[model samples]
Target: MPVTVSIAEFFSSLHVSGQVGVTREALLPGDSEQTQALLSRAFQDACDDLPGGLKADLECCHAAATAAIHYLYRVCQALVDRAMSEEQVAAICAAMPPLPTSPGEMFSQDLALRHLPELWSMARSMSDSDPLVTGIEQAALRFPLSSVGIALKNSPDLLSLRRHDGLWRLYIDRIIARQDALRLEDASTALAVADALGEHAHSLAPKLAARLALASAPALSAPSILSLHP
Candidate 1:
């Protein structure tokens, strides 16, 4: 029931060079083996940096990594085709591993899902009306810590704020990186995250505080300033 083929044979069988200028290989570039090796290395690197308790849970990490890769591949295919039905989106979402509970588990899972925001943004740009975009948005929001770079519609729930210092620091760093693109709600959420971090906020405070101040500042006309002077 199962068939196995070498990577070269598989690519050759696809007949990638024909009247159709675009090929599956063009859609998903890079050697299959190399891609798998890269994913494996990334997973291992994340595991190495994980906390002692989480480092031992390789099974959970492996599952998360596999889910993330599968989700990415499926979503990318849909994006390339520019035709993802609501049913397809639903199926993809249903296939995702459920969000884990513990902070350690959450962090481990986010190591892979952190790349979702960029894909979500691409989907949004492609067609906000598309169900696929909505599905991707929901997925990104579900992993709040990983989706900090996204211009959130609303603040992440309080439970997301309960992350450990490392996750909080990562969140703040992403927020800082996206500071220029932050919307009003995004800035408000960043301020709340900073408040939660307290002393840990460190350099994030000045940057966020200044941005908030600028956002709250009212625009003044020359006439209004002249009237005030008179």
Candidate 2:
């Protein structure tokens, strides 16, 4: 999807046109106007306490929700394909945290992220010893995003974007390979998905950074790795 309409902007425009903010009252069936308003208001409220104003909140909310929604939709569809009912779907949804207001918010604010060890242990039997695509894949197991930064792109071959550098290229290919199974993009995939991606998949940041430091990308000043948002 080439970026769906930004719920925030859509809402702002509606306000400009004299429409009120979104609310439960606007969620009338088939009322596109009301539906739009609800989405905007919900998104706005979702960020009420975050640092930046509407725009920042929207960025976080949009990213997180998309990440959560994509996975949920896929799981939901598969279950539905198997003739699952609403209750079954609800059960599965119950397994995850509330849908994030945005992918960034989930990455930055969630506490479940600290449980990656538990997640990785669970995936040990599946990927058969860290096949690849580990870091980004872990996001799913965590069930929402937490900081998995652009540093993930670093690889020894990279001329810039040194953080993730070489290891990133290989991971990207694996991610491409696994994209069908996991409904995430590089930017949106979470740490849980990375850890739980394949049993063998180790967090790529350390491995990649060690390589770059060796290849003239400055030494590992400290034990380097992907920084999770706190």
Candidate 3:
């Protein structure tokens, strides 16, 4: 029978032997593949949505994909080792591609940075005080569209969903579906997302209604309830 080695041992062997004898199964974890696939799909969708279905800037896209893969690898390594210092976090952030200023750029950057929020959430659960967690929070703030699920203490003043091309609707929907109050900063944010959904996201309306009701019941502001009507 063949031998099986732990991920740590596999990496250790690479360091000692300077050979890549391990299989993809031994190297890329399942979640890594899933994340990669999601990025691929996002890329395809973005391309399809382009005018005349033309391709995007290949060089920019390649850089985004490379950055994402590198970031994911570093994060996984840190998590596995159960140790990530502030300096390491800072290095990772510095290596990230510049913040996207356009919708197209946002879609491309999101291919990898989208995972930051969930990774940050995981890190927070491990240690709320960890520099890794705080670093991720700051990183997430710069990518609000991709970080909609993350709750920031200082929420940005994004009053219009149109600014993000309504891309954040999906993340908000997921938050609402899970009944995650913390993910939404406050009632105002939730109401804004709900209003943006309008009739387009009918399925989420009831859930949104319930969430808003529960959130605003203490204050029960008439204006907040009326905004949900029309």
Q: What local distance difference test score does each model get?
A: 0.55, 0.35, 0.55
Clash list (residue pairs), candidate 3: none
Residues 1-230 of candidate 2 have per-residue lDDT tens digits of: 23233334433443345232222111223344554455445555544633233233123243344334333333323232435454554454444545433334543223223223233343343443432124323343343223232112232222121123222333343333333223232223333234434444334443433332344345667887888999
Q: What TM-score fits each model? A: 0.58, 0.24, 0.56
Worst 10 residues of 2 by lDDT: 153-162
Residue-level lDDT tens digits of model 3 in 7-125: 33433343245332332222343344444455566577655644344453422354455455455446545554545567866675555556555555666666556566667777888
**Regions more than 4 Å wrong, model 2:** 1-29, 51-71, 80-230
- Which run of 10 residues does model 3 get worst, by summed lDDT? 18-27
After the best TM-score superposition of candidate 3, give how far the Cα of residue 69 lies from its true spot, in angstroms: 3.5
User: Of the candidates numbered 1 and 2, which has the greater TM-score value?
Assistant: 1
Of the candidates shown, which would achieve the greatest TM-score relative to the real structure? Answer: 1
Q: Residue-pair clashes per candidate, as listed?
A: 0, 35, 0
CA error at residue 224 for candidate 1, angstroms: 17
lDDT of 1 by residue, 127-189 (tens): 778777777767666777777666656555535544454555556556655652353356545
